[model samples]
Target: MALIDDTRAILGDLIAFPTVSRDSNLELIAYAADRLGAAGARVHIQTDETGHKANLVASLGPETGGGVVLSGHSDVVPVEDQDWSSDPFELREEKGQLFGRGTCDMKGFIAATMAMAPHLGDLDLSRPVHICLTHDEEVGCLGARRLVEEIAGWDEKPSLAIIGEPTEMRIVEGHKGCCEYTTVFTGLEGHGSRPELGVNAVEYAVRYVTRLMELREMLKGRAPAQSRFEPPWSTLQVGRLAGGVAHNVIPGHASVDWELRPVSDADHRFVCEAIAAYARDDLLPAMREISADADIVTHVIGEVSGLEPVDDNEARRIVSALTGANGADVVAFGTEAGLFQKLGMSVVVCGPGSIAQAHKPDEFIEISQLSACLDMLQGLAGKLSTAR
Candidate 1:
């Protein structure tokens, strides 16, 4: 059978599962496990605490050190508020594109890996080719961390990993780290008639927001002049804010959810410490004047660490060879690549569609793009066959 045939079939099946981050992906995990097992690979599943979501790892070839990993997430973003012509879980083909929720962002890559299964069965690989699929990638790359932890304990860890996020098949060697935080401010509430008698939580929140803005500017100004990233700099944004319920009363509490995208891990910590300092020195004392219980609480929503490009590693050479690109570049978005990198793998981000189509109402991957991805995976298989 043709590679495209298997990939499309698998893509159809994968999209059928509503593997939204908030939902369990056990169904999808089971389906993947079956496919991998049938393909003559050794499959192992790591489930979350509730045993609802799962991370599936399958290996083709020897169990010893040094191999390649084809990694992707099983979760898709929600389609609730989006307007779509068809159900998000159902694949729709039109004008040489496959329309579906996860097609581009990216069940397509998972399908491509599955398409390599038959070829893998035929190959006598000395170095294993491991396929790592995880859930909750959309929810801050959560599942991959645990999956990486599992991979770290393997008898022979894969030397390189390819994170199959949408990149039109170009090799992405680096990306920014994202750190999300939710902060809550507390104050004593009093009637609006005597504002001085109570601390206004909303007012403190504004100050906190203002301080964050200043920090954002400071970080932006310190960004290096050279970068392959789109914006080429770190960024910060306040995503949500909630507080008061009535106009005549001071809000006892206010909360803000914000995030920072840093160019490196060190930069991420620096920003976190900066926020912590601001809450302690500037906001807390003023709040305590109104009530001893008044305070600001800051906690991490989640963080995706950045990947720094490796210099002429085997992984880079393989990706460049597969994509036929003169060079690889870095992205501004966060990805699961850093986690694999944390496991001592030289990782790159390269896959089928454009990220522009991701998380949109009408998500899709071009037929040609899917074909290209199959070629890449197939090409990798050939490389392994020879390298072994």
Candidate 2:
């Protein structure tokens, strides 16, 4: 009960910082570092090239190998343009639920971890319990990459990682990988009425989008071998598009931002290669015919690779065992689990709220859900203690 009280206030403080992915999260990171340090964990910070965003890692228990690492992102999605009943940054308790922008999306998990730091320090363990928190997870799992690289250098890597990504406390073993790209098509511009005089970049972009749709259908038909996922297959869609100026001009520029979520690792590269081939052989040459300067440019924005837990992975097994779930399920939404998994640590996704509530206005996590998660976290600490 004390932990819950402490967690609620910590989450409120965290929510107030407004650590949006687009903004620097150093304030939040520093707060976490200070807390963990005071609780007697050796804290380390990993910063991006710009030194703006950061990922913080800390450890309790023994400094040796083979303990659990609890991980979560410190960043929240932007609250701008979202309709909310109250100030999105302020945490509100209403009818046994905590309402805030990142309360469900993830600051809640981070709060739980911080609150547990004291208990973890009190426990005597055979192996170290590491805490890994990162920024830019809502953007693309970028900060986790830096954190993973740091973990790799350690003499003793954690045996498993639990990424608390608001999965309603279910053990999640897999999810689709997401890759986003911005494609720009440049063509010759001329008078709109002089049809043959210039290349219409917008028209060419339409062709590219149509091609993308066809490819999407092709991928949709190839069912993934797993039944855990909802669609059980890969998917693609165009998220944003921009082009042209006025009705009177043949616009020379068009750009479409699109993304693909592949069911597996092999599927991700296959889809990327296919898109590149289509750009090279189909769209580029035709656009070039109108003007030598015509070109199609593809820029990768961010990617969250599909997580594939190793057979009987400790992370997956332990979370499933603790939650009384027989098997782990896959989710359609991406998480930071894949990045942690790539660090030679078996990873599982399990956390407090439903993904359904994430990113929506009036987002909340039930008090019961928070209570359940704390119970599980305490249970996990007990498991680690006994194993030692």
Give candidate 1 misplaced runs (Cα > 4 Å). 386-388
lDDT of 2 at 74: 86
Best by lDDT: 1
Query: Would you list the clashing residue pairs of candidate 2?
Result: none
Which pairs of residues collide in candidate 1? none
Model 2 scores a TM of: 0.91
**Model 2: how far is 387 from its true place, Å?**
8.1
What TM-score, over all chains together, does every model reach? 0.94, 0.91
Off by over 4 Å in 2: 193-197, 386-388
Worst 10 contiguous positions by lDDT, candidate 2: 220-229
lDDT of 1 by residue, 89-172 (tens): 999999999999999998999998988886897799868888989989888888998988887887777898888999999988
Residue 213 accuracy (lDDT) in model 2: 88
